[model samples]
Target: MFLAILASNIRLVSHWSESRGVYDDICYLRQAHLFQRFGWHGLDTSLAHETDGYLAGKLRSIDFPNWNEPTRAPCHTEIADGSKWVMTPPPGTGFVLALFPEGFQVIPLYALANVMIGGFALYGLWRAREAGSLTLAALFGALSITFMINPAKASYSMAPTMVVCALAGLVTARLFVDEGRRRLMMIAAVGILLGLSASFRIANVILSAGYFLFFGLSFLIWRTRETFVAGLTLGLAFLVGLLPVFAANLVNSGHPLVSAYGGQDTAAPHLDPAVLRAYLRDTQFPLMVIACAWTALLWRFANHAGVRQLTLLVGANLALNLAFFATHPVFTPYYIIPILMLSLWTLLFAAVFTRGPVQGFDRAPPGRPRPPEMLSRV
Candidate 1:
């Protein structure tokens, strides 16, 4: 199933690359190429020359270099033909590109990384199931991937980061759910995964914050805060987990919180509050329906501890995604990461709901007939 999904994604990306005349791909490809040639710090000179050279080459190749004089901006130097001058690739993406050896095509490398990340997410789900049950685990994993693997959205520029975030979320969830004596280690591990997710996309810092709050609250509610030891332990874990993202942002953007992709004003015009609200209302209606459907499906098995955990995770992720839509000017497909995460948990809960009754039947008295199968034979 994983291989089939990956093959489909590859085919989709190939079709999009050839058929779509969009410039974002070229811009990202160029950034990847430049990163491969000159490390991150070396982007300045090469970016300028490459931008000019690409434009000049495009003009010569297409026989219309001077055709759109006003449309061409000077700052658009780092991108490929048809790309906007001011647009820049995300630093994390640039770093990924830099990891590739010279002469390797950047697009394929980036796509491959996205594919592998998806695989990692599946593996994490399987691991979660190993700690519990396969049906439940597979359900969650498939739903998450389904949300992400939609060709229309998944083939976009930010897909890699989205894949990374999903995998990180899965790993974090697995760490928390799996029973273990190494409480401190598990907390630290969750933090590290959250940090990695934030590094991929700065907005994921909000998800990390959510995780911290959820964890602290869960601990308090469970009455596990007997000692200052656990509180101090969680604090250190949070700090350790955030260090990677904070350090990367500080070193790359000179701001601990800011990402390479600037705010709404820098990227595009901000929508007015009224306009944004209307747009949100329109967009969120369908998402809310999906969320409710998922919840209803999961609610059937809410008696299980795992189902309950997944429910909370999905609820928190939905809240975060909606909160983001309320404040942010620009909305992109990548912002659906939280939604995708929630979808995974929904899948898991559905799986558990479906399987729970079956298990209960299996444990019924030997003389009693099995309950009518709710699901059709496999």
Candidate 2:
């Protein structure tokens, strides 16, 4: 399954690059190069130059053809007295791309690595299932692969799919790892992964809010010093991971929280709530509504503390995203793909934990309870 996904991703990306149809990928590459050269401050100095080069050359190239087509040009907006260009997308994807060298191999390498991460995550989920049903696990694994092959969701060197995969891995680890200093370490790693995902897409910070809420609830419900320490460590690790992004933003825009698109009309009322609802229905991403239903239905069966908490966090993240996007003036099918992927993974998690214990699956070391029991103990 992993090899198939990896091969498919590599093939897809091998054909796509800066020369293809105009997309957010080039902006990511440009930002990556800038960051590599002079860091965040370099972005302020290089945005205009990068944008001009892309617009006059790469944008015009339009599939690297001989004739330049002006009609199909991408609509880009400039800011800071035309010194900076906003791609109108999150910088998290750019940051990820920045980690690799700018070459044909970069995309394939990223694709391969992401596939491995996702495969590991899905394998962990399958192993964590208490039902001990290989059939069910295989089905969910198939679902993951199906989602992964969708170019709009996964092929593009963007943040959404990457974020979903990271979040899913975090939740999977939470479900499987036994409570101890090791669990604390895993939690901290999860926090860092969450932070890294958010760096690609700032709105992902809402997930951090959901996670923190769960941690707080765990402290209240479980009242264990381990839980408290784990929560603190996770939060601190996430914040530390985010420092680079904060610094980059501060250097670029003079405000840590402000993005390149922050100056644009983001909160103005553009569509009626009814219209937004219609759009969401069309996009098949009625996240807030579906989350409410899933949360209600899944809560009673969730055996592990981690599963229950993750269920709530996933729902909260969905609700937050729904509310946020509802107010925005624009809508795109791709915008909701991440939310859908997240919803599916969370549902899978619920399925794994709620299956009740199978004979072989439920056992731990002799005379010891399962990991879920440890989670229950706080």
Candidate 3:
């Protein structure tokens, strides 16, 4: 499965040219060019700094209207003094591309990503040691690898976002299943992954909504110092991982927290029949249905309290993500893919998924009142 997916991704990306129909690709490449040339100072993506004509050439390649005008470029929005125009998406995607030499970035970027995700699939295979479990794992792994090409290919930022979602999914399973000193470490790791995802696509932060809900509920219901510290650690780690985006925001928008995106991208979401139809017509919707169905099935018949909690988290994440995008005015081919992928991956590795002993949160003796604080000790 790994080799097949790797070869497919390599062949697909091999034919891909730097200049394509997507204008967003050009902006991402231009951002990479800026970073490659200016180092950390490249965070300021003002058009005035385009002294080399690289951005112009990329724009002209696509025959973009008014290629010479910086403000007219797609995905580049004007901010502050009508001079500093920047791409709405954060610089992480560009920064990843900037790591490679010019004219040889995209293929390598995607190839390496295939390796990472494939390795993850293999890890899932290893985790499912039984025949029935292994068959389910194998099918899910194949679908996951195949998914890397469909909706995952709609945008360059999605490459990194997909990788982050897969890793976070695995860690999320551990977050619910594993009990002991490693729990705090896993929480921090998940937090860092969540924040790092935002650097690729600002909306990717929504990927953490489920974790936020789960952690919040656990703390509120249990009211324990452990849960409190866990939630605090997750929040702080996310801020730390989000530093690059904060730096970019500070450099581009003149505010660390304020986003550079404006116009339709930031407009308040409202129901649109056309947008709704588009989602239903796309592969994203079916993937979402599968995720929701799997969550519901697990919620109904799961044997372990840990798996139940994980399922609940998956449910919350799905509900929040779907609600946000369903009402969004603009629709994209891959907008909701990340959340769907995240939910699927988390479900695949759910701890105590098989029928067995229900050893989860230790219970208080029947004669004594059960302490609510024991809920998230895992």
Output the number of the lDDT-best candidate: 3
Error of 1 at 137 (Å): 6.5
Candidate 1 global Cα RMSD: 7.8
lDDT value, residue 30 of candidate 1:
48
**Highest TM-score scorer:** 3
Off by more than 4 A, model 2: 1-10, 36-45, 48-55, 63-91, 99-106, 125-136, 151-164, 171-177, 216-231, 269-297, 346-378
Candidate 1: Cα lDDT at 358: 36
Clashing pairs in 1: 51-77, 76-85, 139-347, 140-347, 140-348
Model 1 TM-score, all chains together: 0.64
Candidate numbers, best lDDT first, in rank order: 3, 2, 1
Separately for all candidates shown, the number of backbone clashes (residues 3 or more apart, or on different chains) is 5, 2, 0
Over 185-269, each residue of candidate 2 has an lDDT whose tens digit, in order, gives: 6777767766766666665565566567777887899999977987898899888767766766665666777665665555575
Alpha-carbon local distance difference test for all models? 0.50, 0.57, 0.84
lDDT comparison, 2 vs 3, better candidate: 3
The collision pairs in model 2 are 92-199, 92-200
Residue-level error in angstroms, candidate 3, position 171: 0.7
My TM-score estimates for the predictions, one after another, are 0.64, 0.72, 0.90
Per-residue lDDT of candidate 3, residues 1-378 (tens digit):
667877887789788777776888998898899999999998888887888999888889988889998778888887756656777779999999999999988878887887788888888887775576677678878887777777777788988898999999998888877767899999999999999999999999888887888889989999999989999999999898899999988888888987788522456789989999999999888888889998999889777788888898899999999999899779999899999988988888883244332346554678886566656554
